[model samples]
Target chain A: MAGEVKFGILSCANIARTLISAMKLLPEVKIHAIASRSLDKVQSFAAANDVPKETKLYGSYEELLDDDEVDALYVPLPTGLHVEWVLKAAAKKKHILIEKPPAHTVKELDVMLEALQKNGLQYMDGTMWMHHPRTHKMEAVLHDSSTIGRICEVHSTFNYSAEVAYRRKGGLSADVRGNPNLDGLGALGDIGWYCVRGILWAYDYEMPKSVTAHPGASYNEKGVIVSCGATFVWEDGRTATFTTSFNTGHVMKLLVVGVNGSLENDDFVLPARADRAGFKVVSNTSWKDVLGGWNRTEDVQEVTLEIPQEAHMVREFARLVASIRDGSGAVEPRWAEISRKTQVLLDAVKESIENGLKTIDV
Target chain B: MAGEVKFGILSCANIARTLISAMKLLPEVKIHAIASRSLDKVQSFAAANDVPKETKLYGSYEELLDDDEVDALYVPLPTGLHVEWVLKAAAKKKHILIEKPPAHTVKELDVMLEALQKNGLQYMDGTMWMHHPRTHKMEAVLHDSSTIGRICEVHSTFNYSAEVAYRRKGGLSADVRGNPNLDGLGALGDIGWYCVRGILWAYDYEMPKSVTAHPGASYNEKGVIVSCGATFVWEDGRTATFTTSFNTGHVMKLLVVGVNGSLENDDFVLPARADRAGFKVVSNTSWKDVLGGWNRTEDVQEVTLEIPQEAHMVREFARLVASIRDGSGAVEPRWAEISRKTQVLLDAVKESIENGLKTIDV
Candidate 1:
């Protein structure tokens, strides 16, 4: 709080590259330290991302956790290692910015949350888009009873065609996403996390009554899901469906239909343009032409982004960490609560898929 | 066979107003006659559309069917009356252009198909978009294999909010879509018809192996579905989901995600503009930046429409009828088959819904 929120990087994952660059853009945040199992990977990542000379480099995560200069930590490790490192960082009293699929399971997330709360450490996931100015604007519309009305149906998808040269050249079985000892949850954890989060965000994070996985889940040779879909049902009859894949062309879309209006965007997960983000809204529709087709008015609301979404996420997390450090704020349970609901929904979907698309109560 | 194809219209349904106008746009088609049980309704309809004075007007459908000058008939009557009038029109050896949900049930559609085939009369359902030049272009991309690649998933939806002054004043119980006795299938028959057709079109008419209805289907007091969704699964693991509603803001979208690429348009059921229609395609996408987000290269392919899709439909139907009349061609049979397949899928969805979201084979 007195100087800056000094952050420590816990892994050298590919996502860490972008995240570290994003964190560097914030004047109130400093890269205090970086650590990786392989010292060479840590040195290369720090060099490529322009980590300052004063930033400590460590060959082991334990050394980074022991650094008293670090005020916060960012975890971009694989799902399997999240619980171990998250608990260690929490015990060190470092505010945390953890990557998605916050933990391998809801129980693991519970442990991480308990540790953070007991230590009075701030916690937030790396769902960068949630901090974007566009998201707040979209949320205003979705929450306004006059604009989007009551949510009736939501459909979200996040997919990318990963059947490219690298996939073929590397022979996917050994890929981190496909490796059982690494990110064993596969595409469901990697991408479907966004889809499930999108649905929960649209409905104000109210968990669904039940979830049912759809058929056609494709898995790799190592039995990690590469593609999957599911349906969520609420007690009020509102329903949502989402699909995610690593086997199709890149597509990230969210469509929310309501009784009075609707909101939609093709780049819900990642804004197509970094400088600007927008979503289309429609309202007061009726039958206009003789063809019995509809007549609805649409308006594109754009939000100018002075700082990229990832940077905004880092700034938000840093602000929360600074507030807690200065005794001006308590940890916001909202972020971790949202992540847990998303994890619970994902677990239900996976269980339903394992049970052959049977209905599973959330 | 001669100068023009004569079309007799049975019923003064609102859709006939559009169909009659579309037919009038075709040079080789004539609005030869009009009929309704209420003579005043028929007279008003003819006058409102400026029907040629030479065109006959009848107080009853039987009179129009008996007219020897009428070579073909377009039936836009309510679903409850489709079978009765279709059989009578077939008995008159009139080529038929029937409205969608050509029958209340698949069995009813079978009866009408048999009548048309037995009578050796050409038949085509009024699914106007099928004849759109834009459709032909989109089909080329979807089927090219090199462009959209093999279809992996399809998502389609068609919904419109019925909250206008007229609807409020009329209170909607008497509206055909909400009236079980008139259009029993409600949103499923009226809008889901297009969604199912879009999927079938993408797959080149290969019927899905199974369909499972989703929960949250809204129904009217008479037990007519006002909103519904279903998932279609193919033997090859391809999947499709469709949602339709009469209680939401207008939305018409078809998204086709493939292994190599994707094709999508916001106005798949109805082109946003009549003059030109376009769909966005993306392929061979990769990360162009270091944001850890994908960079999908998109191209908007536009197809000019010389005539409205509805007019194109009329012209195509007239051309087929002319060929049959001149002895240069037999009935196409293709249009009828497509309608039947759509009906079969609709029936399966309805059965799945009735059975509590149980999977039903097509």
Candidate 2:
């Protein structure tokens, strides 16, 4: 069941570039094929990467998933098209590691996953920051009673400029970043999802009973927020906040506050090279020594979670496949779980965007 | 008129400790007398800190202001009491340096200043941080044509535990810090005012044409805000935002973004002895330096903002008196200007707070 995972990337959106490069570093994986809306793009990508034999090219995603040899699919389409492709691929029995956010609405997200369950396919959202081992290290500090001493409060902001090259009119009059119908939440949905998802995931998805989202200072009052924030009132009385802006230059960081001290990491995601990212864990105690006891700080034992980038996607897909092959796994895919908890707040964000920061009764 | 300015200590509040300590270092100041609700309190302070030749201990502020020799009075009373005492002292023909948020209501603030003008007394609300010469130095970078560029946006936040403590029953009882009536806008009025005032001041009183604040988020939502944020829009399509929280832990910082570059100072008002407070100005050249020849890296110079402890207050008060004595000097105090602006927005804030973040028609 596991000599190596055969992975096939769908399309050549720039986001897949990092994961495709990451796959090259791992021997247990093979980038067997790629499909784009255009055959020329897929074939060119296959040749440019020196993809191994059996690196077939398909003109359409439907044609690609129909092949019995194709084990899984990665969906990184424009935000609007994601649900269509995800449901279609899931119906074909191909597992998925879809790009964020998998769908725009919670109900739409649910329908996509239910179809997946009806056909039995694996799914994972392209939330890569959590895959980094540092995320868990931060969580351990929060959960570890001995360290960080009773997590008092936490705050994080993931603000990046998505409109640097963004234009209302593209080669075909398409805007993957600007159009709200295509891109759910501008600043909030794109990268802000990470902050929302990160805090929610770190806190074990203790779903907030109520949430208030605000586009108080949004651009043009397009309510297509250049900056929007929300407060999540969790069941356990823990609170987390999310702040993001599509207009601001770039500053994506996370902070975990505790009574004893805090764990602050600005470089939330590690780059493929690892060295370029000063992805450090600034804590009061030596985290490396604490997580990796004596003699374990050596290079091999340093706990660098260099997992397959799409490999998490690939593996999550494979795990879904293996689970369906065995009749069980998580109740729903991690992607679905994440989408459900965050999407309502996201929808409330949509409502907040439209209705001006309302409280969503979750 | 040509000599050092004589001063009177009008109260024995803990907040006044710093300014009182600073008076010892400057020979250009004369501590004329002291007054308090309790004669014992003023007597104890006079003995402990060295009140000049034959200190006058008044049982009431009335007797203290009645003394003809006292040129200026320093009031560090509860936030709510500023208007009352300021009115009384101003009527007695004494220069007024009242504590921050000169009054809870804009109406009261207007009347308090009217009395000052009526009596020909200089007036300013005590905002010790503004007095710090470094604050002016930082402002210089924003104003300086050479270093920082055109100001586009600003993000500021000032929060700590003082909010929650104040909302409890009798929290401010006799303690000014905990009383909402005395505090005016609670967290927003207390700290957010600084960021708002700083930006507006830097922009030549760009009265935000409109403002939209978020619905209050608080554990105890009935009182003032535990956390609140607002977006201030000016007439010329410029914008700024400020957030203040009594619920969150300590962080008093400001970040100003400009067209070509940005400057950030986190510890703007830390005690004068605090390490590394001086502003760090970064230019388009900073990017160049990071790439190897970064823009002229102007290291954070150790700026001795002539306002140490309360020397800014003492010196400023002295300057106001000298102006009165010589028939010429800096007549209008910085506090009066800042207070007028504060009252304007604070008046707007009440509507902003009540109307679920709508901009008041100021």
Top candidate on lDDT is: 1
Error of 2 at A312 (Å): 6.6
Each model's DockQ score: 0.53, 0.10
Question: Against the hidden reference, what TM-scores do the models get?
Answer: 0.96, 0.83
Clashing pairs in 1: A161-A248
lDDT of 2 by residue, B114-180 (tens): 8888888888776666777677777778787666566656656655555224444444333444446
lDDT of residue B205 for candidate 1: 94
DockQ for model 1 equals 0.53
Off by over 4 Å in 1: A165-172, A291-294, B163-169
lDDT per residue as tens, model 1, B1-362: 36699999998888888887677778899889999997898898888877789888999999999999899999898888988898998899999998887877899999999999999998899888898897898888887898768888899999876434237547445678778888899889988999999999988899989998877788977788888888899997788989898777778889999887789887877776677888899876665465645566788999887678889988988888999899998999999899999999999999988997888988
Q: Write the per-residue lDDT of candidate 1 for residues A1-362, one digit (tens) a residue.
A: 35699999998887888887787788899988999997898888788877789888999999999999899999988888888898888888888898887876798889999999999888899998899999999999998999878898899988876556247557456567777667877889988999999999999998899998877788998888888889899998888999898877777999999987789988887887788878999887666566434566788999988778999999999988888888888888898889899999999999988996888988
Q: Best by DockQ, which number?
A: 1
lDDT against the true structure, each candidate: 0.86, 0.62
Cα-based lDDT at residue B202, candidate 1? 86
Q: Which CAPRI quality tier does the interface of model 2 achieve?
A: incorrect
